[model samples]
Target chain A: MEMITSAQNSKVKNANKLKKKRDRDKTGQALIEGYHLIEEAYQSTVKIKQLFVVDVERLDEELMTYAEEVFEINLKVAESLSGTVTPQGFFAVIEKPVPETTQAKQVLLVDCIQDPGNLGTLIRTADAAGLDLIVLEKGTADPYQDKVLRASQGSVFHIPIITQELSEFIDHFEGNVYGTALENALPYQQIPSQDNFALLLGNEGEGVNADLLNKTTQNLTIPIYGKAESLNVAIAGSIVMYHLKG
Target chain B: MEMITSAQNSKVKNANKLKKKRDRDKTGQALIEGYHLIEEAYQSTVKIKQLFVVDVERLDEELMTYAEEVFEINLKVAESLSGTVTPQGFFAVIEKPVPETTQAKQVLLVDCIQDPGNLGTLIRTADAAGLDLIVLEKGTADPYQDKVLRASQGSVFHIPIITQELSEFIDHFEGNVYGTALENALPYQQIPSQDNFALLLGNEGEGVNADLLNKTTQNLTIPIYGKAESLNVAIAGSIVMYHLKG
Candidate 1:
């Protein structure tokens, strides 16, 4: 039942600060932009810090009743705080999700999927496939990024996504680790599988990290026959995820 | 070489007009933003109407030599003309590429791919697959869209892309059309010869249009052992492209 009238308000200032990845990481806060993203995040039960409604007159009472704290900003200030040009007039600052450190059942790991859209889509697909957890290595883009979050459409909220050292967790589980590579790899379908597994996706250019590759139990590829140097990294990852499903 | 200082200058106005699809379609010349895309258009021997450059003093001579008419704009104008924030400092008001009408040896017919990223990636993939032509039916996004252009990385310039009356072209080809679907279609790997083919990609939500599906010489589905609902459109197209290769 609070309204933040000034962009200079301490809450607005702190909310705006979450735009940077460093800030999000340091403070354990994530920024979800636009009406749809925030709605998805809400539906997924991400803990909210504060809500900023640009035009209070237009907001329905149903949405207003859900927020713990609400603030109103002029369109300009809302746009200033928003990353996208077409601001949705509403935004939220929410706490970062802490995924459970579970024993691997089935996992999709992204090495360095750089394209945010692709990365988010990959995560969404992984979640939709009923995979237990998603792991991101050191160089991968932040899964909490605004664009990635928006592209994910709130899967980031519910999905147990973790970023950790690859070597730290390499030998900790008892499942096969199948990574995609261009050469000396079997076709994805040809690789026989058991129930417990982890499928690794390499970076767009360099592919799976060398350390992880050396430890991988199986190496596989899509059996590409055309002239494409390689398929898009996200597409490759999605295919592997689909192929590896138990 | 003329420097356009005022945003209101007539040519500057025309150049700026290209920022939106309505303007682009109205003028028959589209704004190809970013250095790589302009480079792609220029390298392809396509005619350039007006080459808009910014920070001209910083450009290399190779790029400088390719422009027919050049104008200098500030970063703001360049940003306005570009759809993305990181303006490439160079944009081209170029004629839409029309590839030779030579009978297509193999064609790709796409139906209602709504995502620009997906459509652009498909176009780029089609080019990589050595496809002879690309056909976009109604409900397809503009191929000249900035996101598609960037995602395609200029492959559109080389590929013969057509957005036209689907029935007429499908009628003329008389080649076997393979439409992708969920079930009841032959596994892609079992398909016959590669030459004289048209591959149909449909909407992600709706699958192929019924009219086009009826017209398909055959219906095919990629063999999937996984539980994922469907492969990403670009990946699905690539998998089929790989399988259909002779």
Candidate 2:
């Protein structure tokens, strides 16, 4: 077993570079930390390029066989690669899964969601709702970001999430394209659930772009019965996704 | 106008101490940052004990009259008091609202929700769903914490949140008390919506406490259609909340 004790080791340095979007995009790989996510990646169709663990003895037998390479890393290396204050001591470098080419029956189209946590939660909720695909607008937060991967709770590996211009995707999509809005929209309950549909959720402060909303098959809103001005984007998206999944 | 240029000033030091839960409990005050939250506190019935501002001109005129005492603080003092990387240049010391003694028709009972962000999002979602009151179990994250305040997005000011034992509250409650569970639970949609009901949500890792689940009128779950293990606590709680609100 190869041991890498220094944070400056080439393998460790290269893995640390994956923390940035550009590096991940260029290399077609992502760095995932913690045990659960690494296990999820191993179970999924995604390929594990390398594994860095502080305790080789603690690595799952199944995961050890799956990884192409494994290295024993010290606490310093683990800390340097981790985004969190308390590094979980397990990290995996995995190749990004290719997007599915088949047409998805049910989809969740995210438009300009700026917050990584919100974006990640949406992915997890969509996965649980059994949406076939998640289409991210160009400006949405990068799914490979550590905050998103952690927040998704490993569901990112379970689901098919791809980045594409939402407008272009909407142009070709054939379904009940339901956009959420606060005004001039029927209550979400009034809209009948459809087997093939795309639910569009937008930015936190600015909702679905007006041009995009115009293109939607119908606009709907969840009624606000309290003093809160509006629901959080992720929360609102989850309610609509579950309702539509029916 | 009094100007506070030093971070160590008695007033500034005292205000900063409210950041800790122990100090907040002892003083009966919580420190809130950002322009939006400060505005929300001013509009609410809650009393604002002190206001620290980097720029007095930026403060809302209405809020100016609402705060008991306003101090112009330097950037250094503002940064010292803020939890965010970039301070919004506004902070306030507010007394926690007195929980309403009257019985609430629709309530949200949170049991040992440990994550501050999840707790805050639940509070915001409950407020949006128009749940009348939020009852937090003692082990749950402090709603007055900085992370909770930021994640709640000022919904904390709109609703009444009080900490209490789940068992005692359930024993006295008259309405339907719905607890969420993964097994031996009916689909949430199968349950009829009731005007007077309490929705009980539990910790992220643990579902509703076994003892609490045994006491509820019914245990419900949102169906999982994908390979994902389960929905996020906040997401799951939000889905049930909007459904029950109907």
Candidate 3:
């Protein structure tokens, strides 16, 4: 076991910089925080590079045993690496899983989801709905961001998320790709379920980009029955995902 | 129209304090920010007590005409009253709607949802799913908080929200009351659709308090297919809400 007492420790500073997208991309690693997330990672067999605990005595024995390297850090140092208001006393630096090429039956294609929370929620929902693969386009928010990770509630570790040009993926995809849009689209429930399909959810403000929408096999809309102008993208996406699941 | 320049202006100071629950309850008013929220409030027939705008020229004519009192405030004053990171140059102080007791077909009873964002999302989903009324218990997050408002995306203006004791409300309620729980609960999908029901969602951590859960007609759980411990409360509630809709 190692001990890190200073907030200015090089490792602590480096972990803090993982908050940025560029740093995460460069290192191909991201920080996972809180007991729930760390537990999920260990149980899922996600490779954890290092684990830092604010209170080693309070850490779970299983997690301590599973971690590749465990370090006891001062509270101040632990807090410096956490993005949450209340640090959960556990943090891990894990290698971003290299997503395998998937020919999965059910797929979710996320297009330009900007809000970290919404994107994370979509990931969690997809996982629960038993979607096999999630493909993110360039404009989508980083799934590895701390807020996104927290919002995903550790489903990110359980699901396979890969980033690629959505157009290329759609072109190569052998299944029906349904894009959600408000205009000239059949109600989602009207779209009969099939064996395998890809659902494309759009940006918060903008519907799926024109190019992608043009390429999708069909467009779908979740009926809104109230005075709300539109449903939140994440909610709409999740509802449609569940409704269309085979 | 009156022009207010100083951040310390009496009206400005008072509105800023409304961020606190005590002040909001004392005044029976809450601050609504952003162009979209202001627009929603104006169009939803939600009474606007005062409208404060950074640029009168940019203010929509109908909103200015509809407000009981409209003030043109300087940029600094607008920023001072804003709870968001980016002020959208529109602010309004609106009287909270006095919800009418409803015996509608579909209803949602929120027990003690602690996250402002989750509570707001649930409200929005309930509205979108066309549930008639939302009853909040004492310990739920304040919907008037800026974060909840933002997350709701103005659905707060469209929905009827009332706070009551869960036990009391359930005792007098005419509909089937379903509580969500993880233990010994039937799958939500297995619960047959009903014409009228009250779905009760509990605290984020503790779940529906044991007392309330014990009182429900039946408990429901959304099955998780992935290794993720559980679905987000809001998402789970929304999924069930939509599924069980009459």
Per-candidate count of clashing residue pairs (backbone under 3 Å): 3, 0, 0
Candidate 1 has an lDDT of 0.76
For residues B159-215, write the lDDT of model 1, one tens digit per residue: 888887677788888678899988669877577656789999998778888887788
TM-score of chain B of each: 0.92, 0.97, 0.96
lDDT score at residue A82, model 3, on the 0-100 scale = 79
Each candidate: what lDDT? 0.76, 0.90, 0.86
Please tell me the TM-score of chain A for candidate 2.
0.98
| Every model: iRMSD | 5.1, 1.0, 1.6
Ranking by lDDT: 2, 3, 1
What tens digits encode model 2's per-residue C-alpha lDDT throughout A1-246?
899999999999899999999999999999999988888888886899899999888988888888999999999999999999999899989999987777898999999999999998999998888889998888889999999998888889877888888889999998889999999888999877679999999999999999999999999999988778788899999999988876
Q: Residue A74 deviation, candidate 3, in Å?
A: 1.6
Model 3: how far is A121 from its true place, Å?
Answer: 1.1
lDDT of 2 by residue, B49-77 (tens): 89999988898877878889999999999
Instruction: State TM-scores per candidate.
Output: 0.75, 0.98, 0.95
Q: Highest DockQ among the candidates is held by which one?
A: 2
lDDT by residue for model 3 (A127-159), tens: 988889999999899999988998898889888
Stretches of model 1 off by over 4 angstroms after superposition: A54-67, A70-77, A181-196, A218-229, B1-96, B102-107, B112-115, B170-246
